[model samples]
Target: MTQITAAMVKELRERTGQGMMDCKKALNAAGGDIEKAIDDMRAAGSIKAAKKAGNIAAEGAIAVKVADDNKAAVIVEVNSQTDFLALQDDFKGFVSDSLEKAFAAGYTDAAPLIADQESAREALVAKCGENVNIRRLARVEGDVIGAYLHGHRIGVVVTLKGGTVELARDIAMHVAASNPQFLAPSEVSEEAVAKEKEIFMALNAEKIAGKPENIVENMVKGRINKFLSEASLVEQPFVKDPEIKVGDLAKKAGAEVISFVRFEVGEGIERAEVDFASEVAAQLEASKK
Candidate 1:
């Protein structure tokens, strides 16, 4: 039997982009022969899977898992290269399994959970012939937690200090729909307000020009106030009951919103634009050669 050293594992990981444990296992199986380990990993589709890592996986699902006792909930976003693959049972199953593991471990950061699921993710990538990624995870915990999923594309988790699960769920649903940026006016940062003010002034520069200074200041303040009301979750009108605000609704329920996490599929990923017809033509041209 040959011994595998840390340097061997590190070399394998660097060469293949595989997890440390996987590299160690492969090295051990290959009798400490780095070349043999590489060959075996390539044959097992691990290398092929890693090669697909560069593909942008901006399409996928958001999964939410709430604890049995309703004290905590986890929301995760997993991505695939295309929506077609994302909708497949295999990819959905991976997302579900990943969310369960994160929730079970009470993982606030996605790194460890992602590491734990590396093998499964690589397998899915190899099988599906696309890039798959466990993009992010968010955990919310409080006296009461409520979670809502909107057609697997959007998920929201809400934490409340003193509220019924039903109320919390309602708020979560609202969040999934409204996608507010801040929990309240207090949570809105001064920088954000300043940015908004700058944009508002620039857009209305002509109208505010030559106006009285106090009047202009009043106009800017009013616009900033409106911006805050729109951007803050508590100030938004309840989706179910347009007559009432979310803050008022929570206050009526004797519940205070602690925090909320809302995730929408593919929110921030920059995807490559492919010309399908040209791609097909190129493929056909290559085939002729």
Candidate 2:
């Protein structure tokens, strides 16, 4: 019998980029032999799966699933390298399965859900012949939940203490369109306000150079308020009815917006630009050699 050590597992994980438990199990199965563990892991496709980790998977769909009771909803973004793969039925199925599993298990974060679907994810990657990644996940559970998915590209979930499904869905749709950064004006951070103010002041420095200090202060204050109105969900006008603020609409409906989250596929990822003809030519040239 071989005694497996944490140090051995760490080394194997570092070399292979596989999960800690998977490396540990491999190490234990190989009698604490790191090389044999590596071989066995590769034979099991774990190494091949891990190798796909470096590929850029920035294009995919946003999947939103609500619990049967409608009290909870989960949104997940699963990424692939190209839209072609993203639109595939198999890829869509994986995203749906991942969201369902997360919703059923009440997962609020991506880490646990990713771990839970590790084998399935690996299998999907192999089947797709491309890197498939569960990029982000968010779940909201509340007294009432409203979810809206826009063309499978953007998803919004809203939670309220007291609200009709219509109100909730309306708020979610507004969130999808407005893309507010804060739930309310009060939720806007002082640091963010200061940063925006600084930029505004710098840009208008010459215009305000000779103005009275009080007047300049008022100008800055007005600009900041305008910025807050645009960035705060409650302060923004409702998308359906532009005359009323979202806060007023919520209040009229006897509901308070608890929290909301919006997800857009590949929001922050920088995708690589590859020249396909050149890539094919290079592959052909390499084959001749």
Candidate 3:
């Protein structure tokens, strides 16, 4: 058997970020073959990733890539089990690469983009020692496309018939900030409207008590209209200029919001609550074992 030197153990530790003892063991296990040691380490990392696959990875970032001509763009979300992992340069770089690939492929649906990224994603998962997911992606194209990123947490893409980048960006930023549910009141589903009406009526039953049935009906209608106004993007008060409605702002800019998509990292994922002290103690106990 080849002897494992201190230099070999140090090199393996530096390459894999594994503990000194772990690196030495892997090096010895590979019989002093550095390349084989790396492969073994990676395999171990893959095992850890598999064990972590079910962990909630609700913390992550969004990456947006726009074409040079501003007529098309793509946004992708990469999720990590922890915010600390999400903030790493390597994780961010992976997300950026995924965005560029999605933009280049011009995929309207996320399925093809995800399928193309599987191998790279698995490698990333192993490297990060966590389960990483290319959670979702969206592509938008129009005569004019604008993209906005609010830090790494939120991303917005807007498609317009005709608009300056500034106008589109403003709209996109509004979308990121306001989280509008629909582009227009008409886009609000009938089922949603019905649900909101039922809720409003239930909540304000006492206020309409003893009133005429016609008057109560009008009150419910008014409340439903108000709900739509608040939920619809076009009717929302502009985030930059609250005096004007978003629709009016678009009209004044000689453009209209054709379409927009907003993505906020971890918007729907259920995050697990972890007790840090218990976790560290558990790790210490495991090491002793």
Candidate 4:
């Protein structure tokens, strides 16, 4: 039997980026065969890493970069189970690398960027020991794309055509604050418009009791249009100057807001429900053991 020397283990550990004890065990198992041991560690470590995929990542960071000409930009969100993990070098480094890849990925399509069919997001579950998701991504290729990240909690990306940097950034700030889902009133779906009308009719129909069918229909349309405007970014009042509408401001400035994307961490994730009484009883039972 070949004696596994410390030097062989050290070299294998350096190459594999794995733990010291794990390297030592693999070396012992492989009879001091450095290459075989490194391969063994990689396989085992990756399996161990896979077990962490189920962990919920409700915390993480959003990042964005604008090209020099402002002709394009990339935005991404990398979520971790805890803020501490989000701040880790490995996690943060992966996010930046992902963003860089996105910029060069030919187009800004989110599906292709995050797709495990091509992306390694699923495989990464093992290496990071935490669920990491590209929660939301945005890319714009025309004229300008500007962005703002409000702390780690929220991110905004605005696409602009024929606008100055200040205008573009100010719009990004607006998106961060308002959190509208659609870029323009037209982008609001018919279903969403109908739903708003239904809610308004339910709430106010009593007050307008016995109103004519035409009058009721007109009232519903009025309410639905207002709802669409509120839910759409272009129709919303500009954050800097409430007197001017966002869309109108763009037109006045010789530009248009092509679209925007906003991501608020944990916004779409359903939080786990905790049964407090049951949890307390379980804890008590465990303590008595």
Best by lDDT: 1
Report the lDDT tens digits of candidate 4 across residue range 73-192. 877777778888777877777788788888777546667777632236654554555667777677766777777889877887788888877788889999999888788887878788
Which ranking of candidates, highest lDDT first?
A: 1, 2, 3, 4
Give me candidate 4's TM-score against the actual structure: 0.75
Estimate candidate 4's RMSD in Å.
8.7
Which stretches of candidate 3 lie above 4 Å from their native place?
Answer: 1-49, 275-289
* lDDT by candidate, in order shown: 0.89, 0.88, 0.84, 0.76
* Candidate 1 residue runs with Cα over 4 Å from true position: 1-41, 44-48, 277-289
TM-score of 1: 0.82
Give the lDDT of residue 126 in candidate 3.
Answer: 64
Which candidate, 1 or 4, would have the higher TM-score against the true structure?
1
Per residue, candidate 3 scores C-alpha lDDT tens digits across 183-202 of: 99999999999999889889
Candidate 4's C-alpha runs over 4 A off are 1-48, 110-129
* Clash pairs detected, candidate 3: none
**Residue 233 Cα positional deviation in candidate 2, in Å, after optimal superposition:** 0.3
Poorest stretch of ten by lDDT in candidate 3: 45-54
lDDT by residue (104-218, candidate 2, tens digit) is: 8888889998898888887787567677889899988898899999987899999988978889999999999999999998989999999999999999999999999999999
**Residue 273 of model 4: what lDDT?**
74
How many residue pairs clash in each candidate at the backbone level? 0, 0, 0, 2
